[model samples]
Target: MKKINLIIATTLFSITFSIGAFAQTETKIGALIGYGTEIENIGIGANAEFPIMEKLTISPSFIYYLPKDESGIKINWFEVNANANYYFLDEENIDVYGIAGLNYSSIKVKYENSFGLGGDFSSSDGRIGLNLGAGANFNIGSSITPFAELKYVIIDGGQLVVAAGVKFNL
Candidate 1:
């Protein structure tokens, strides 16, 4: 509970900071499909980009991994990330950026006996993590932009994540 609160507070602070620093700027919101190395599964999520400066942006995204079941055990996982992206190469067609961020990961597990013996159990855990990576955005002279990112989260066992999707500017 305390950890969750901390994550919320930190996210709010980053958003506030970005708005305070740049009140008038274009924002982008979009959906993405992601792959996580630790879970070896694909996830789908939403993301938003808030430009804080000409070459810097604050991005927040969430990813939920598809639940997997094996041998009567089920697992569910998700992550929330707030990252700062520094664009090294900003162009009309493509924008490349470096990433650094905070990550919060949670996973749950449930087990059930197939024989219907009434013996079942469940468990869950959450952890705070850090991320570092790089990504690029492609603009085709429209309101919609496609982007791809590869980031590694350093936390509880560590994981590599890759995402790609389109964002709409607004």
Candidate 2:
């Protein structure tokens, strides 16, 4: 009889904790601006974050860099990424998280040769890279959350990315 009573108590506690965790989950959408070495210019991006567990979130984002003119060549770059973030500090108004992800990046180049042959050329190859980062979210008032992050991308020659953005919870 005592064993059965203890089992019931444990099950109830587990169910209660699970429900409380789910109630704290949130979904947010945001826009970001990033600057990186490989990108060669500033990029604008957008992302959506979905909480999957008590302390874990998955975010997907797309970024497009402004075309840069280096010498006579025009370089265009962009990236699409899916990231998983783990929150070490989850608070009512502040959260700090670590990030890891995979990114697909592409670059295109256009230039005119000395022979007066003008044409557009692009890389037939795209790269899949690894991203590691950390970020913080400051929840203010009722709906707005401002964030800042730094990411290191391991790709061709590597890149260091810095980003800041604001998100609205929905």
Candidate 3:
């Protein structure tokens, strides 16, 4: 948990400086924090975005789980994702977006019993998906805009995944 927090902090620091230096360009960069539900687990993820077009962007993200209980013991997982966002409504500084892309996930399961099965399991595969979400910019007095969004990732076998987050634009 300590290490995860440290990595997130470091990533945010780098993003801050990089955004400051790249503010003059059209490149949009920011950090995202949000929760997701997959396979009965709650996840927290962070994302970094880079624009490829006025209506398109690429975002790479990672997620982790706080220790959870199943019946009596504890378990956890880590996930990673990369996807593209297409702005369906691009106007002013706000954009309502839809996304379609692939994701790679690594899930780790731990058990109370030291002799339990599935030792340090990791699964990585291409998941094809889509997301429908909206984001609006907060027009404060600063160049860094505040935004909020909600999205759902539709997985195979009709499993529904949801995410919501607040972000600072740069």
Each prediction's TM-score versus the true structure: 0.87, 0.79, 0.61
- Model 3, poorest ten-residue lDDT window? 120-129
Where in model 3 is the C-alpha error above 4 Å? 1-24, 39-42, 114-141, 156-159
Instruction: Give one digit per residue, the lDDT tens place, for model 1 in 1-170.
Output: 57766766776676567655655677887899999999989999988889877898889888999999978889999898989999999888999999999999988999988798888899989988999999999989999999999999999789999999999887
Q: Could you arrange the candidates by lDDT from highest to lowest?
A: 1, 2, 3
Q: For model 3, state the Cα shift of residue 141 in Å.
A: 4.9
Model 3 clash number = 0
Give RMSD to native, each candidate: 2.6, 13.5, 6.1
Per-residue alpha-carbon lDDT of candidate 2 for residues 36-81, written as tens digits (9 for 90 to 100) = 8776689998876778878898777778898888877778777777
Error of 3 at 68 (Å): 1.1
Report the lDDT tens digits of candidate 3 across residue range 1-170: 45545545655665566567557654444444455556565666666666666777766566665657676455665555556777777566566666565544434454444567655433233344555454544445455655556556665542345554545555
Candidate 2 Cα RMSD after full superposition onto the native fold (Å): 13.5
For candidate 1, give the lDDT.
Answer: 0.89
Candidate 1 weakest lDDT stretch, 10 residues: 15-24
Model 2 misplaced stretches (Cα beyond 4 Å)? 1-25, 114-124
Off by over 4 Å in 1: 1-23, 116-118
State candidate 2's TM-score.
0.79
